[model samples]
Target: MNPLVSVIIPVHNGAHFLPDSLASVFAQEYRPIEVIVADDGSTDGSAEVAESFPGVRCLRLEKGGVSRARNLAVAASAGEWLAFLDADDRWFPRKLTEQVALGEACPEAGLVLCRVIHRFSVDIPEWFYGPTDGSAVTAYEPSAWLVRRAVFERVGGFDEARSLGEDTQWLSRAWDLGISHLVAEEIGLERHIHGANATGLIQNRRVVFDILRESVERKRARRAIR
Candidate 1:
C-alpha cells in the first residue's frame, strides 16, 4: 500500500509565489495526500491567496516564526511521510511520485532527497551532490527531502528558537539520528530566486546561524561522549 504523504508549506508573506507553489502541489501525481499551508501572520495577501485554495487546510498563527508555523502544520497533518516545500520553491510534476517510489524501493531509508536545479533570471545551474555509487547525498534543500513523520516527531519539530538555518539544522539532527538515506535522481526541484525570500535576511541575522552552529556542535559532542 502507498503511504499517505502530508505536504507542509510554511508561508510568511508568500502571497506573490503562493499560488505557484500550491499549483505545484495540486499537480503532484501522488494521491492520498493533504496540503497544509501554515501561515505565520502574513500581513500581505498571503492569507487570502491561501484561503482561495479548495481543501487546503490553512493554519493561521500569531507572528511567531517559520519553525513555529511548521510545527503547527505538522501537528495538524496526518500523513506517515512529511514532505516540506518552501513557498518560493516548486517541484516538478514527478517530484512526489518519484520520491515515494524511491521510498518504497528502500523501505528502511528514513529520508530521501533528489537533485535540484537552481533557476535564476540570468541562467540555470545544474547542481548534484552524492557519492559516485549513489550511496548518500551531501547538502540538500528542504524541498528535495521526503522524511518519515515518526522520525520528525522523535527528533522534535524544527527548532522554534532558531531564527534561520532551521532547515539545515533539522536535517543535520536527522542525519545524527542514524536514519539518513539518499537517492540521487535527475527529476529535480526548481529553487526560485527573489528579493522577498528569507535567505538574505538569514545571512544578515548572523546570530541565527551562530545559534544553529552551537546546537549542531553540541549534538555532535553528545554523540562523541556515548
Candidate 2:
C-alpha cells in the first residue's frame, strides 16, 4: 500500500553527520513522505543544517534525550507509518520503497525491518564485531525498522526514563502483544558505529550488559505472571 511515511530523525550535536543522514532520506525512492528533524538541544548548529533542506520540518527541543526527541517528532508528524533514523545513520535509496511494499505483502506485521549494513570507524575495536567478517549487526535497530503509527499509541513510545535500550524495550512490548515483525532481507540502511553512535554503541560494555540484563529480568517477570 502506498502511504505517507513520516521519517523522524533525532540529533544531538551531530552537525558533522546530519547532512548525510538527511540526504539519504531525500534520496528515498518512495513518494508522499515527510521528514522531521528533532534537534535535542544541539550546540553544534544542527538545527540550521536541517533547515537548509526544503520541505523538512525541524523541531527545536531541550536536551531531554533521544527517546523524548523521537516522541515529540512523532507527535508532530502526519504520516500513517513512522520510521526512525538517527542523525548519524543513513538509509538506502529503496529503504522506504522496499519496506512499504513488504508491509503490504505482510499485512499482519506491526513493523517492517530491513537488513542493516554496518560501517565501523577505526576507533571501534574489531572484537566488538557481531560476525567474524562484520557483514552486519542487530536487526532490532530502529534505523532498520518501519513501524505502524498506531503501534506507538498502542504500546506507547520509547521509554523516556531509560537512557539506553529504550527502543528495544518499546518494541518488545509490541511483540508481547502478538504483534509480528516483518524482517526484510534487503539491505536498506547503513549503520555507522564510531565508538559512539546516537543509536546505541557505548564503549562501556558493562553498562550495556546491565541495560540488557534489566530487560531480561523484566521479561522473566512477565512470564512468571502469565
Candidate 3:
C-alpha cells in the first residue's frame, strides 16, 4: 500500500492564485493523498476557495505568519509524508508519484527535493534570474520538498519566531541532524514570481541576512560540539 502523503498549503490573501495551486495538487497522479490549506487570516476568499474543492481541508488561523500556519496544519495532518506548496506555486502532475518512488528507493532518505521552474508574473531583468539550465539548484524552496513526517517532527517544524526564512532555518536544522535527502532531477514545482512574493520585498532582505547570521552561528556551534 502507498503511504499517505499530506500536502500543506499556507495562504494569506491568496485568492487569486489559490485555485490553480489547489488544482495542481488535485491533479496529482498519486492516491491516498490529503490536502490541507491553512488560511493565515486571509480577508480575501482564500478559505472559501479552498473549501470549494471537494476533499480539501481548510484550517483558519488568526494571521500568525506562515510558519505558525504550517505547524498547525502539520499537527492536524495524518500522513506519513509531508509535502509543502505555497498558495502562489503549483506542482507538476507526477510530483507526488515521483517523490514516492524516490522515497521507496531510498528508504533512509528523510527528505526529497526536486527541480523548480520559476514562472514570472511580469518581465524582469535577466541578470536577476539564476541559471535555468535544468541543473540541481543549491537553494531549497518549500514547494520543491517532500519530507517524511518523522523528519519534520524531529526537526521541530518551522521556527515561529521567523516571519521569513522559516523554511531555510528548518532545513538547516535537518541538515545539522545529518538527515539524508535525495534530489530528483525532474521539475516538481512551478514557483510563480509575482509582486507579492515575500522574497521580492526590499524590507525582507534584513530578515534574510539575520537568518544567514544565525545559521552560521549554529553551524559553528555544531562544529565545536563535534
lDDT of 2: 0.84
Q: TM per model?
A: 0.85, 0.88, 0.91
lDDT of each: 0.79, 0.84, 0.87
Give every collision pair in model 1. Answer: none
TM accuracy, model 1:
0.85
lDDT tens string, model 2, 1-226?
Answer: 4799999999999999999999999999999899999999999999999999998999999999999999999999989899999888899899899899888787788899888777776565643545435575546778888998877688888889868767777776787767888877778988877767534444444545665676678779989999
> Model 1, residue 69: what's the lDDT?
93
Q: lDDT of candidate 3?
A: 0.87
Candidate 3 on 63-161: residue-level lDDT in tens? Answer: 999999999999999999999999999988998999889998998999999877777776653334555444445337899889999889898889988
Best by TM-score: 3
Badly placed stretches (over 4 Å) of model 3 are 125-127, 132-139, 202-204, 220-226
Instruction: Kindly give the stretch of ten consecutive residues in candidate 2 with the minimal lDDT sum.
Output: 198-207
The backbone clash count of each candidate, in order, is: 0, 0, 0
Candidate 2: where is the Cα deviation over 4 Å? 132-138, 198-226
